[model samples]
Each structure stands twice: as C-alpha cells, then as structure tokens.
Target chain A: MSHVYERVALIGLGLIAGSMGLAMKAHGLAGEVVGTARSKDTRDVAVGLGLCDRVTETAAEAAKDADLVVLAVPVGAMGAIAAEIAPHLKPGATVTDVGSVKKHVVEAVSPHLPDTVHFVPGHPLAGTEHSGPHAGFATLFENRWCLLITDAGCEAGAVANLRALWEGMGANVEEMDADHHDLVLAVTSHTPHLIAYTMVGVADDLRRVTDSEVIKYSAAGFRDFTRIAASDPTMWRDVFLTNKEATLEILGRFTEELFALQRAIRTGDGEQLFDYFTRTRAIRRGIIEAGQDTEAPDFGRGTSRK
Target chain B: MSHVYERVALIGLGLIAGSMGLAMKAHGLAGEVVGTARSKDTRDVAVGLGLCDRVTETAAEAAKDADLVVLAVPVGAMGAIAAEIAPHLKPGATVTDVGSVKKHVVEAVSPHLPDTVHFVPGHPLAGTEHSGPHAGFATLFENRWCLLITDAGCEAGAVANLRALWEGMGANVEEMDADHHDLVLAVTSHTPHLIAYTMVGVADDLRRVTDSEVIKYSAAGFRDFTRIAASDPTMWRDVFLTNKEATLEILGRFTEELFALQRAIRTGDGEQLFDYFTRTRAIRRGIIEAGQDTEAPDFGRGTSRK
Candidate 1:
C-alpha cells in the first residue's frame, strides 16, 4: 500500500501502538512513525525494537510535524497527552485514538485539541492479554474489526484516510457513533472482561481449594477466564471506571440470568437448565459462522505455550 | 505399552467414551473395545468411525465377559447403566466412569455395582464444546488430568491398571476423594460453564444489541465464553443437577466476589478494581508455568477455524 500518512505520531509505546507502528511499516502505509511514552525505559525499549523510526521524550515532540497523531495511552491518560500535544500538532492533522472505551476517550481528548486538527476517535477491537512494546506483532489486527467513532465532525477525507490505514494493517474498519460504540463494547468486551476478572478472583479467594489446585486443573475451563483477567490492570481499571454505566447495566442483566440458572440448579429443574443451555449454543455457532473466532476445539490451543 | 485390559466395554458412545476408545486403540491399552449407546444413530457413527471394534445393542451385551467396563454416560444416567450391566459384568472385573461430578457419580453408580467388580469412579478434566461420537479425538486427553475416586473398596491392582490406561493415553492420573473432586471441579469447570451460558444468554436476550452485533464483535472477548457455553446441553444439565450443592456453593461465592467488584465499578473505585485485576494475573501466570495452558494470544487460535 502507498503512504496513507506522511508522518504518524504514536503517543504511547504500548501493545496497540507498537503493533500499529510495526503494521504500518510492514504495509508501507506511513512514511515515518515516531513514538513517545511516559516511562523513559519504555521509550528506550520501543526504540530498540524499532517500533518507530525514532523515539521522542514527550507527546508534544512526537506530534510536531505529524500528519496523523494516535492517542494510544490508557483512557485516563488521554486528556493529558492531548493537552500536551495540542500546540504541537501540525495544522489539519488527523488525530485518532485506540482506547477501548470510545465515548470516554472522545470526551477526554477532544476539548484539548485545536480546531485545526480533525479528531477521529478509533478503537481497534484487537488485543491480547500481553502488553507493552515487546508484546506486539505485525499481524495482531488480522481479520479483526476496528471501530471508528466519527461523530465529532471529522472531515470525510480524514476519516477515509484513517480507515485506509487500518485496512492496510489488516483490520476491517467500520464507522460507529461514540455512544453506540460504548454500549456495544459493554456487551461484547467490557462486561465480559469484568466477569472474567470476578470469576478468577473468586477462585483465588476460596480457602478450601488451594491456588495450586486451581492452576493445575484450570484446563477444565477456568483458564480461559484467566487469560483475559491477566490483562493490563491499569488499562482495564480505566475501562471499567470510564465505562461504568454500560458495564453495570450489563452486569445487572448477567446476575439476573445467573440467579435464574442458580435457582434451576438448586431446584433440579433439568428442563429449564437444558433449554437455557441449548439456546446459548446457537450463539457460539453464530460466532463461528461470522468468522469472528476459530471453530477449533479449545481455540486450537496446544498443551504448550507458544 | 501393553494392553491394560483384555476387553474394554464402553457403555456410551459420546465424546468422552469415543475419545477413550480412540485413545486406548492408539496406545494399545485395550485388546478389544466394545461400545453401546442409547441412540442407534450414535452407535452407527461410532462403528463407522471405528471408535470400537464393535458396538452392541445393549449395555449388558457389551459388558458381558468384559475385563473393564466404562460407564461413560451422563452423570444422571450412570446409575441406570450400572444396574443394567451389573448382572453381566465378569467376575473380578473393574468398572469405572468418566463423569464430571465424582461424589454424585459415586452415589449414583456405586449402589448398583456388584461386590465382585472393582469400582473406581474417574473424571477426565478434558473435553471440547462439540459432542457426540464424531467429536472424539485420540489426543483429547493428552497432557490433561484424570482424577480417580478410590474411596470405594477398589483393589490396588484395579486402580493401578486404570491409571496405566490413562497414562498410556497421554493423561496425568491423580487420585482425589469424591467430595473434594466435586468441589474442586465446581470452581474450575461447572461454575465457569454456567456463567458463560448466562452471559451468552444475556447477550442474546438484549434487544438493543442485535445478535449479529454480538457475534460480529465477539473477538473482543465474549467469544471465549461462547465456546464453553456451546458444550453438550444434556451433559451440562446432568452435571448441574447431580453436582447441585458444590456448584451452588461456588455460585454463591462467585456472586459475592462479583458483587464486590460490581460495587467497585459503581463507586468508581479504581484501586479496588486494579488490585483485584492485578491479583488475578498471578493465577494466569501460574497456569502457564504449570503447563496447563498455552501462552499464545487468544489461545493460539488462527483467524480461520481449523
């Protein structure tokens, strides 16, 4: 692909940003990529890994002379980074973010940016439990959906160019409003992550079942929860805190349904339990049919880690 | 490895039973394997796939003169199958099961067994969401745990031979009491499956987020839950019904912990959420270190289902 952005500024040298930098390089979608992180160690490591053409000590320095600036920090940090880079962003630059919670990110970063910059908030719905600069790969976004929040008067040209960059990185881009994006993500991502964290916590707290036993027998099913539960704590904390309402709403519904199943188990209502389980099976089929996940058993996991 | 049993009779031609058949055949752990299922269709498929040397029309016929009888039916069906085969079991034979709930299986099947046969109830901590005869594979139990309930007056030779068969099939065999096994599994498997089913059902029931939306965005994290939720409904229903107390106990504890986290989200308590998440990360690392799971992003699942 041809250069979608002449100069790209990645304001966080974390998993998403590192992956973006590598992907853009692999696809030749960006003429130059510069990255910055609060931690000097992170910046040094990112530079050593060649995640960017060069590393900057500050977000403002990275944003200078950039055609596109990506706010890839934790959601809570977006506002500060945006404020720092506001005066440095080149005129008519397209600014986008890769925060998990779109509404909060837009709200946090938009007020700090100047009118000269086109703000097009985006979230690539792709990640792994691993974090930091070293955890990224070029194919991290392959066949994944990247939702772009374009409700903030983003220019057509800016949005199209950003979409092209994501597509060049192997993601299918879709436009979604911020509010709907938050709610959809609550159902599909935020709520599920919270539940996974909760389940793992409960197992850890149980006195009768030792932690070693939990880890040894995790292949039974609980290990799946742990993979997501082990995600970057600070990033997830920001997600739950910012997207509180939608997550709580979804959790309410989840608890109610869970209570109903619990009652069925207690009452030995086999038919109710059977019917509920049978209905849920259809959704898994739909996911496989949609090509959102593999049909391989246990996600095609081998006994050994790669 | 030499044959552990001269003739092994498998009383149910399902995922666990068929898998055992194939694994035993692969390792030469059983001289001849005979199978039977309530459904003629399942028996036909098992025979067509060569899951057994031959499938009998009745449990008694399969059990006749068999050195090892495996009751691989649902937990709720174990008692009836044990009763049916008790009269036909050979003198000095060994009988085992592959139920998920150990205490319940012991209670359900022990009373029906004759004194001449050694009863060693076992539960293999392995399976896929897919079920029926065709879903079985020779490596399903590879490097997985197989817990044997030796509380019954099982002879040492019988237990040793059963352990050898599981070992030959590439499983790590361990001995655990019935009650302890049930409780441990309630935390690791049963409760997780129930929670997954509940979350998927909630997503399906929500009118605001269409089903297609959930499926399309499942790679965000919800897809992991759906894979386990798609498990055999009948088998899960039997599990919940038979293992009611331990499952209910774990469910209570899970809800308590979940409510605490939910309140943290409600109150915007980032510290509590962050700490809880951080603590859970250790468990995942322990699982990977213990070789219970893969460290690959997304369980090493390819975008395509294989």
Candidate 2:
C-alpha cells in the first residue's frame, strides 16, 4: 500500500485513533501520523507505544500542515476540538471524524471547520468493549464497515481519498447520509447497547439472585449483555445524549415489542413466542451468511480466548 | 475413570443429551449409553455420529434395564416422556433430567416416576445456540454449572451418583431447591433470552434500515443478541411457557428499569445514564474476574474460529 495522505493528524488518541495509527503504519497508508489527546496519561501511553510518528501537545499543533485531520474524540468533545484545530487546518486538507453518532458530530464540528478544508464525517462500525490508548489493535477495522457522510460542500476527491485510506486500512467503505446513519446505528448499536446496560443494571439490583451468582452463571445468556455493557461509559453517554431522538425512537419500539412478548409469556401464548423467536432466528442466519458473525456455537464464546 | 452407571439412557437426543453421551463416552463414565429421539432424523444422526452405543426407537425401550435415565427433551415434553418411560424404568434406577426450567420439570416428571426409582431433577447451566444431535461436543459442559434439585424423598446415593457423573463430564455440580433454581434462572437466562429475541425481532421489523444493512453492520453489539436469539425456538418457547411466573417478574423489573434509563435519556440526564452504565461495567468486570467471560475485545469473537 502507498500513502493516501502526506500527513494525517488524529485528535484524541483513543481506541479508534490509536488503531488507525497502528494500522496506517502497518499498511504504509499515511506518510506521517500525528496525534494528540486531552489526557497526559493517554498521550504518554501513545508516545510510549509509538502509535504516532509525532505526538503533539495540542490539536492545533497536530493539525498544522496535515493533509488529513481526524477528530477521534468522544462525540461530546468533537465541536471544541474542531474549533481548537480549525485555524491550523492546512488549505485543501480533508477533515473527518470517527464519532459513532454522525449527524450530531457533523452538526457539532462542521461549522468550526474552514470552507477550504473538506469535512467528510465518518464512522467505523467496529469497536471492542475495551477503550483507551492501549486497547487498540491494527486489525480492529479489518473486514468492518466504515460509513462516510458526504454532505453537500464535501469535495468528491477528498471523499474518495478518505475512502481509500480506510479501505487500505482493511475496512469496507460505504457512503451514507448523516441522519440515516444515526437511525440505522440507533437500531444496530445504540438501542442494543442501552438495552444491554439496562439488563445488567436490573441484574445488579436483584438482591435475591446475588451478584456473585449472576457473575458465576452468566455464561447462559447474560454474559453477552455484559460484554456489550462493558463498553466505555463516557463514549456511550455521549452517544445516547447526542443521538437522543433516534436512540429513544428505537428504545420506544423495543419497549413496545418487549411488552408484547411479556404479555405472551404472561398469557402462556406459546405460539406467539415461538413465532417471534423463529423469525429472529432467521435474522441470525442472515448475519452469519453476511459474514458479520460466526455460526459456531455460543458465538464461539467458549473458544474465544486470546 | 470408572463407570458411574452400568447403563445410561438419554431421551431426546438434542444438544444437551448428545453432549452428555459424548462426554460420558469420552470419560468412560458409563458402561453402555443408549439414546432415543422423537424424530427419526435425530436418531439417525445420533447413530451416524456414534453419539450412543445403542439407538432405541422409543423412550421406554431406551429406559429399559438402564441404571440411569436422562430426560433431555424440552420442558413441555418432559411430562409425556416421563409417562412413556415410567413403566419401563428399572428398579432403583436414578431418573434425572437436563431441563432449563427445573420446577416445571419436577412437577411434570415426578408424578410419573415409580417410587422404586429415584427422581432427581438437574439443569446444566450451559449450552450454545445450536441444537440437534450433531451440535454436541465432549467439552460442552466443561467448567460449566449443573444444578441438581434434590428434593425430599430423593435418595442421597442417587444424588451423589448423579453429581459424580456430571463431575466426570467436567461440570461443577451444585444442589438447589427447584423453585429457587427457576427464579434464579429466570433472572439470569430466561429473561435475557426473551430480551434478546425481542431486540432481534424489533430490528427485523424496522423498515428504514434494510435487513441487509442490519446484518452487514451487526458486529457492533447487535450480533451478540442475534446469537442468543438464534437459540432453538421450540426449547425457548417451552422455557418461557414453563417458567412463566418468574420470567414475567424479571421482565417487569427489566421494563421498570429500562423506562428509568429511557427517561434519563429523554431528559438529557447524562449523569444518570453514566452512573448506571458505570455500575453495570463493574458487574461485567466481576463476571470476567469470576472467570465466566473473556475480557478480550469483542468477546474474542475474531480469534475464536476453531
């Protein structure tokens, strides 16, 4: 692979940014990778890990002269970081983001970016429960979807170049409208995460079952929820807060469906429950066929030890 | 390892019973293992896989002269199978089960058993989404819990022998009251399964996000739910039907807490969402510390292909 950008600045060196640094270096996709984080500890760790060619103390310093600038901070912090680095952005440079909530991120950061720079909001549809500078792996985005938002005013060449960078890093790239992306993610990621968090919370409050027992016997089904609920709280908080309408919309649908299923259980409607479960099983098959998940038993959880 | 029973019979050759057969044979825990399933296809598959030493046509024929009989069918079918096999049970034989809902199984199967036989209800808190005879593996129950309900009138030697057999199959055994076991499972397994099914169903029903998109982008949290939702529909249907009261109770609590979190989201209460999410993360850490799940990213989903 060859360099897609002369220099790339990654603001907020967390999992996505750190992984981008490692993956870009591994694939030789960027000429020079410069990164900055708000936390000294994160910056120190990134420097120690050699994640970036240059570790700067500020987003502005990192953005200076960079051909591509990635706002890899939490969604809530995107606007401030965008403003901080706006004046320093090189002319004709492309600025993108790795925020989970794309609509709010575009709303948050687009105004702060100069008209000379291409602002293409992007979200990589991949993550591990683990976070921080040390939690990233080079192959994290491999075979994952990275959706880019090409709102009006975004240059076609800049979007294509950004897409090539992500594809070179081993992601399948697609373009989506910012609002549609948020709604789709609300169904696919945000609402499910809230549900997982809520279920784990409910289990925690159940005194009769005991937390130790919940932990010990979690392999049955609840353990999957725990894995999801273990995601970064601050990141998820920003996700729900920023994508409020879509997340709540999906959650409301979830609750309505949940009540119907609860009534089925309460009324001993085996056929209703059976039909609903059977339909969901077909979706699982679709996912496996799509290569999004493994068909091995228990999501291959038993054998998934590193 | 010495034989725990001279002859063992497994009725309904599904995942659990088939696994028990393979595990027992692997450990030399039974002198002879016989199994029977309602479907001819299942029986043929069991014989083809060499899952049992003998494949019988009927539950009674499999139960005949066997020192241990395991009713491994769905919870709703336990009563009928018990009635069918009760007449042929050998004297002093230990009659056990591997049903998910114990109280209902005990209620359904106990009355049909003769007084000369010891009826000890057991539930192995382990399984995968896969079903049928071909889904069994020798290590399915390894390091998992198998709860035995030793109610009054159950012989101590029978309980011990059953526990020893499970131990031989690499399961940690525990004794609990049937009612408490049902309630605990409702909180841990049944309700979680229902929630997963409902979420998957809701995703399926969403018109805005095409099914292809949902499947393609499912890796972010939704894939886990799909795996859980892919569990055998008939078995889950029976689980909910049999364990109605407890499942409904947990679902009630789940909805109550979900509403609170929903309200927090609606009101932009980031603190409430953050604290709840943080508390749930501690539980996830506890589960990892207790060795119930992997702390690896994505539940080590990428590396677990073997």
Candidate 3:
C-alpha cells in the first residue's frame, strides 16, 4: 500500500503502538514511524526491534512535524502526554488515541490538544494477553474493528484520513460516539476483564484447592479466565478507574444476573439454567459468524492450524 | 497400548464417550467398543464416525458382557442409566464414569451397581465448547487430567485398570476423593462456566447495545466468555444442579472478591486493582509453566501451526 501519512508519531511504544509501527511498515502505510516511551528500556527495546523507524526521547520530539500522532499510553496518562506534545504537533495534523475506554480518553486528551491539530479518538478492538513492544505482531489488527470517534467534530478530511490509515493497517474502521463506545466496551471488554481477574483472584485465595491443582487442571475451563486476567495490569487498572461508571453499571447488571443464576442452582431450577445457557449460545454463534472468533474447539488450542 | 479392556461399553455417545471410543480404537486399548445414546440419530452418528465398533439401542445391551462400562451421560441422567444397565452388567466388570461432578455421579451410579461389579467414578478435565459425537477427537484428552475417585472403595485392580485405560487414551490420571473433586471442580469449572453464561446473557439482554455490535466487537475479551458460554446447555445445567453446594460456595467467594475490586474502582484505588491484577498474572504463568495451556497469543488463533 502507499503511504497514508508523511510521518506518524507514536507516544508510548507498547503493544498497540508497536503493532501499529510494524503493521504500518509492513503495508508501507507511513513514510516514517517515530516512537517514544516513558521508560528508556522500552524505547531502546522498540528501537532494537525496529518497531519504529526512529526513537524519540520525548513525546514532543516525536510529535514534531508528524502528520499523525497516536497516544498509546494508559488512559490515565493520556492528558499529560497530550499536553507535553500539544505544542510540537504540526498544524492540521490528525491526533488519535488507541485507548480501551474512548470517552475517558477524549475527556483526558482533547482539551490538551491544540485547535490547530485535529483530535480524533480511536480504539482498536483487538489484542492478545501479551503486552510490550516485543509482543506485537504485524497482523495484530488485521480483520479487527478500529472504532474512531468522528462525533468529536473533527474536520471531515482529518477523520477520513485517519480512517484510511487504520484501514491500510488492516483494520475495519467505523465511527462511534465516544460515550457509546465506552458503554459498549464496558459490556464487551472492561466488565469481562474485571470478572476474569476477580475469579482468578478467588481461585488463588482458596486454600483447599491448592494453586498447583488450579493450574494443573485449568484446562477444564478456568484457563480461559487466566489468559484474560493475565493482561497488562497497569492498562487494565486505568481502564477500570477511568471507565468507572459504565463498568460498574455493567458489573451491577452482571451480579444481578449472576445472583439469579446462583438462585437457580440453589433452588435446583434446571430449566432456568438450561434456558439461560441455551440463549447465550446464540451470541457465540453470532460472534463466529461475524468472524470475530474461530469456531475451532477450545479456541483451537494444540490443534493444527494453517 | 494393548487392550486395556476386552470389551468397553460407553453409555452415552456425547463428546467424552465418543472421544473415549476414538482414542481407545486409535490406541488398540479396547478389543471392542459398544456405544449407546438416548437419541437414535446420535447412535447413527457414532456408528458412522466409527466412534464405536458397534452401536447399541439401549444402555443394558451395551453394558452386557462388557469388561468396562463407562457412564458418560449427563450427570442428572446417570442414576437412571446406572439403574437401567445394573442388571445386565458383566460380573467383575469395572463401572466408571466421565462426569464433571464426581460426588454426585458416585451417589447417582453406585447404588444400582451389583456387588460383583466395581464402581469407580472418573472425570476427564478436558473438553471444548462443541458437543455431540461429531465433536470427539482422538487427542481430546492428550496431556489433560483424568481424575478417578478411588476412595469410593473400588477394587485396587479395577482402579488401576481404569487409570491405565485413561493413560492409554493419553490422559494423566490422578486419584481424588469424590467430595474434594466436586469442590475443586466447583472452583475451577462450574463457577467459571456460570459466570461466562451470565455475562453473555447480560450482553444479549442489553437492548441499547445492539447484538450485532457486541458480536462484531467481541474479540476484545468478550469472545472468550462467549466460547465458554456456548458450551452444551443441558450438560452445564446438570453440572450446576448436581454440584450445587460447592458451586454456590465458590460463587459466593467470587462475588465477595468482585465487590472488593468494584469498590476499588469506585474509590479510584488503582493500587488495589493493579496489585490484584498482577497477582492473578502469576496463576496464568503457573498454568503455562504446568503445560496446561499454550503460550501462543490468543490461544494461537489464525496462526500457522506445525
């Protein structure tokens, strides 16, 4: 593919930014990809791994003269990075973020960005449990949804260009309202992650069933929870803290539904449990049909794949 | 892998029993495998797939003259099947089961068995979301745990032979007390499945977030829960109904831990959230170290496999 941006600055060279760099380079979608991280070690690693064309010591240096700037830091850290790079961003440059919770990111970064630069918050709905520059792969965003907050009143050309960049990097781009995106993600990602973390914690705290046993026999089902719970703690912490209202609201609904299921088990209501479980199967089918997940058994773990 | 049993009878032609049939045949572990299912269509499928050497119309017919009779039906149906096959079971035959909840299976199946027969309940801690005879694979139990309840006072030879059969089918066998097995599974499998089902149900219930959006964007962690939730409804209902006390206990602890984390989010206690999440990561590492799950990203989905 041809270059979508003359230069792209990635602030916070973690999984998303690293993947962006690799994917952009693989597709020839950016003329130059400059990256910076809070830690010198991460920046050095990114540089060593060729995750960026060049490494910058500061977000300002990276943002300077870049046609596109991506804030890929923790949601809680977005505002500070935005402010640090605000003055350096080229005029008419498009600035977007790859944060899990978009409303919080928009609230955190938009005010800090100068009016000269167009701010369009974006979140790619794809990831592995692994993090860091080393964990990223060029195809990470392939066939994944990258939702852009076009309702933020950015110029049409800016939004379209940003969308093209994402699409060129192998993502399907769609525009979503920031608040709606947060709420939807709270239901889809945030709440599920918290539940996985909580379940893993409870298993660890259990003395009767030793941790070894939990680990050894995890293939029964619990292993899936651990995979999700194993995601980056700092990024997840920011997610829950910044997306508080929506996550808590979803969690409340989750607990209510959980209590009802618990009651069904306690009361020996087999039909209720059966019906509830059967209904949920349709959603799984929908996901498989949507090509979001594989239908292979056990997520095709240990299975031959091509 | 010489014949572990002269003739084996599988009393339910679902995933587990069908897998046992294929695995046994693949390893030459049984001279003949006869399978029976309640539905005629399932019996035909099992026979057509060569999951069994022969298909029997009734549990009694399959149990007759078999050296090992495996009660592989849903937990709730074990009692009825055991009672149905009790009269026809061969003298000195080993009666084992592959049920998730061991205590209930023991209670449901042991009473009807003749004193001449040995009752040993077993559970293979391996499966996929898929069900039915068609879902079975010869390697389904490879490197997975098969817990046997030898504490039920079955003959030593019978227990050893059962263990050998599971080993022949590529499972690592362990002896566990029936009650402890129930509790461990409650913490590991039953509760996780319930939570997943409930989360998926809640997502489906939300009218505001269209189902299409939820399905389309599910790869962001929600898809894992959907896979778990998509598991066979009838089997899960039976699991919860039979393992009620232990499941409820784990669910109680889970809710307690979840509430604490929820409070942390509400109060902006990032430290607690981060610490809890970090601690949970250790379990995932342990699972990987224990060889229970692959370290491949996203369970190695869409990746080339050797």
Candidate 4:
C-alpha cells in the first residue's frame, strides 16, 4: 500500500520470478515491471504471459532505469546475474534475490553491487514442486514466509521498504543472517528433499518396474514422499551444489538418528518406537494448529475437493 | 450385493471399521451389521455416530450370530480379541482382519478360528491420518485397493463374496498370499511410516532443544513428513513390531540407496543427482497418471481445492 519502488525489474522468468509478477499485479504495488530470461523462448513466453510491462532478453536490459531488481534464478546463477545487471542498474537501486540458499546468494551477489546500489539478499520461504511461467499465480506468496538475509549493512529504510513490499504480497517477512538461513533451510528443505529423492529412487530401481503397484498402494505412505521428490530437478540440483556443507552436516545428524531408530526396531524395542511415534505426533499437531496446514485426517481424503 | 453372508459383524470402532459400516450402509451390502469395541466409550460413540446398526460392549456378543466377522483392531490386540470372540462366532462364519500387516495378523488370529470357520486376512490399502469411529466417511474406499490374503484355501465362493462386499464399498480387491501382502506393505507402508516418525521426532527434538527455528520455518520441506508422522501411534507401533523383518528389509534397501545419493551429492556429481531427481519425477508422474493422486503441489496450496 505504501510507495516502495518506482520500477521493478525481475531478472529471471522461472517459477519465482513468474510468481513475483503475479503477486505484484495482485497488490498493484509496483510502478513498472520489466522481466528478462536468458533463453529466447522463456523471454517470449514471459511476454506472452504478460508477466511484465516490457520483456527483455537480458538482465542488463531489464534492470536499466529500474528502482528495484530481484534475482529469481538458481543459486548457482545469482552471481552472474548480479554481474550482468550491475552495469545497467540505476543508481541507488535496491537488489534482492529469491534463491532458496541465502548465504550463497548473499556472498555471490553482494560483492558485485555498486556502492550506490543496495544489495539485500532474500530467500522467499515459499515454492511448489511445479516450475515454469505457467506454474505461477498471484497468490503464491499469500501467508508464506519470506526470509531476508544480508550482512550488507544496507539502509534500515531500505530493509523496511522491502519488508513492506513483501507484506503487501501477504508474506510474513523475517530477517535472518544469511549463513543461519542456509543452515535452517538445509534441514527443513534440502534434507527432506534428499530423503524423498532417495526413497523414490530406490523404488525406481526395483526390477519389476512396479509403477502401477506403487501408485495404487501409495496411500500406504509412499505418496507423500513422491510429491516432494517430484520438485524441479534443476532447482534441486542447484540447491545441493551451492549449499553443500550445511546439507551434509544435517544429513550426518539425520543418519545417526536414523541408525538409532533402526537399532531400536531391530532389537524389538517397541516402547522406544511407541514413545518416539507419540512424541512426533505432537509436532504434527503443532504444525496444524499453527495454521500452516490442515488438521483433517489424511488431509480429509474423502472430503478434499480434488 | 449378493447374498454372500447372512450377517456380518465388525469388531472395532475406528476409521477402518467405521468406514466399513458406513459403506455397507451406503450400498445395503451387508445383511446385518453388529459392532463392538473393548471400551464402552467407543461403543457409545459408535452408536451415537451410527457407525453400526447395533453396538455391544464385547466382540463375542456382536459375533454370536454373524455369518462373517471382521477383526479391525491394533495388530497387537488382534490375538486377544480373536480369542475372546472365537467361541461365540456362528458355525461356518468367515473370519477376516483389516490390519496393515497380513502375515502376523493371520498367524495370530487364524489359528484360533474354529474348524468350521473360514479365515481370510485382508488390508484395505486406504486410510487417512485420522482415526476413531467419528472419522470414517462413506466414500473412504472409493478408488482404493484392498488386498485379501489366505493360505487356508478358503472356499472360492466365500472369497468372491468377500470381494463383492469390498466392491460394493468402491474398492478394487485382489487376493495374494499372506506373506506376499506382508512384504509388499512392509516396503510401501510400514517402513515409510517409521521413516516419517523418525524424521518428525528428529525435528521435534531439534525444535525443543536447539532450533526454535525447526518449526517456524517448517515448510522448506519438513512439514510433509509431519502428516505421515501424525498417524496413529499405537497402530504404527504395532505395525513395526509385528512386521519387523519386512520393515527392516525395506529400510536396509532404502538406506543403501540413500547413501549412494548422498555420496553423489558430496562429490558434486550434479549429473547423478539430476538424473536421480529426474527419474523420481517420472515415478511421481506415473503415480498421478495412474489416478492415485493429484499433480497439485502440496495438495494444491495456491488453489482453493486439493
């Protein structure tokens, strides 16, 4: 509702950027939206989807005369995108990113920013297994968290302005140190994703190629893992590569914990298993009570309007 | 529905049996439906919810004149319940169970059945995280699979009649040997439930002692695991204990495959990780295409419906 920026340039037309376009439209918050993608096809598609007021083929072209620029590409691509758009960035333009791994993006992007330009790296804690321009919607950010990470010592006014912009999009903005952001995300997102990938991968290697069997019997518990494992491969690949240390660290802890549970199961320690399962149920209730998701059984399987 | 059983008795008041009661009522599939639970609280609730046409405090009282009896209890309690009700079962009553693990339940209850009885073990591969008599819905079995197992060579006509009852409830029924059903479910349901329980327990521990952050930022991916982890603790505890061997076997396969993927991530083998993630996506697509679930992201978070 407040005037935050005069012009906004989105430097990638993938899921995040595409979603940003829709969100900005919903709030009528941005002055002018310019979008760009590296590939010609994506550029054409972004324009065709009317994701922006004007579409360009290069980040430099999009950021020209822009008051704010958001990098919504993969973590590995943040630095180059920052560099490319740096030359054309308007003086005093505020730059932020929507990559999942914040520390990597901050470190990669902050150093290349001009002294006059503000670089505030952010990781919007929202996404879906879906990708591409068509997969986005104006409400993707509604009620989700947007974690902003930076050690750039940018102006408090700039950070507040960014916060207001996200709030307008219905996101709860939280400020966290970039490294801490990466560490938290490593456990919450990266490790869960790895586990899902592995389980589905294990099923894939079965000699029977029992695809229909797996699907038909998925209500048995395998379906949830499959949904997460179905996320964009390119996005996940970039995540693992860029956030390697934190991911490996959490995984190390996870493996140790997993082994102890395995030992209990092997030794027929039903009490231990029961206690843990009982304790885990409380957390699920907390999540549901927190209004992050549903409280219905099997998410109201028979009642869901799917 | 065919005149398969002159009367059928259901001995449980939870989601499985309650759904059976509602579905039978919906289709006029059963001749008479009598139900009971160990606790009078559940009996009162069952009667109030109309989950059974008649409710009794003891399983034997309900099964006294029934031509078919279904045991729908926690696997740990199956034997005791079967024993208490066995003497009262009508001559030639077909005895069956609706437990997730088939082998142990069949082993526990079938031996107690009278020579005049036909024992069949079955698992309806459909359920929600919710339980209790009030949680059941008439449409719960629609499009779901139900596996029936028997090594006793129960009459083909009896099996067909049983299959017809499930079909009337909107389930597709298949018959498999008890051991095979146990192994298949061990891999698909039991192991996955344990993994989810362990994962949620780890996060709960983290949230309590370390990261108040573990849950505040849960959606990064940890929340999906919580849904499975929220499942009935008593039920899952019994599953792991009763189906230990098969659960452990599938867990071993899962961890081995997981380690391979972990090594690939550590080595920056992007191609390997990408290939694995990509392959798993196909599996998810196959699941969706098979009509097991929707392609919607996290039950279509952005959409109004799941």
Please, what are the lDDT tens digits per residue for candidate 4 over residues B242-292? 888888888899899888878887899999988888988888887888788
Worst 10 residues of 2 chain A by lDDT: A297-306
Interface RMSD of 1: 3.0
Query: What is the full ranking by DockQ, best candidate first?
Result: 3, 2, 1, 4
Error of 2 at A266 (Å): 1.0
- Tell how far residue B92 is off in model 3, in angstroms: 0.7
Name the runs in model 1 displaced over 4 angstroms: A303-306, B303-306
Prediction 3 TM-score vs. true: 0.98
Give TM-score values for chain A, per-prediction: 0.97, 0.97, 0.97, 0.95
Which residue pairs in candidate 4 have backbone atoms (N, alpha carbon, C) closer than 3 angstroms, thus clashing? A298-B129
Interface RMSD, candidates in the order listed? 3.0, 2.7, 2.1, 2.4
Evaluated on chain A only, model 2 obtains a TM-score of 0.97
- Minimum summed lDDT over a 10-residue window in model 3 chain B is located at B297-306
Instruction: Please give, as one word, the docking class of candidate 1.
Output: medium
Regions of candidate 2 where Cα sits further than 4 Å from its true position: A207-211, A303-306, B207-211, B303-306
True-vs-predicted CA distance for residue B256, candidate 4, Å: 1.2
Per-residue CA lDDT of model 3 for A1-306, tens digit only, reads: 778899999999988999999889988999999999999999999999889999989999999999999999989999999989998888999999999988888887888888898999999988889998888878888888899988646799999899999898788999979888988898889999999999999999873446478777888889999999999999999999999999999999999999999999989999999999999999999888988888988877773321
Error of 1 at B152 (Å): 6.9
Query: Candidate 1 chain B — worst ten consecutive residues by lDDT sum?
Result: B297-306
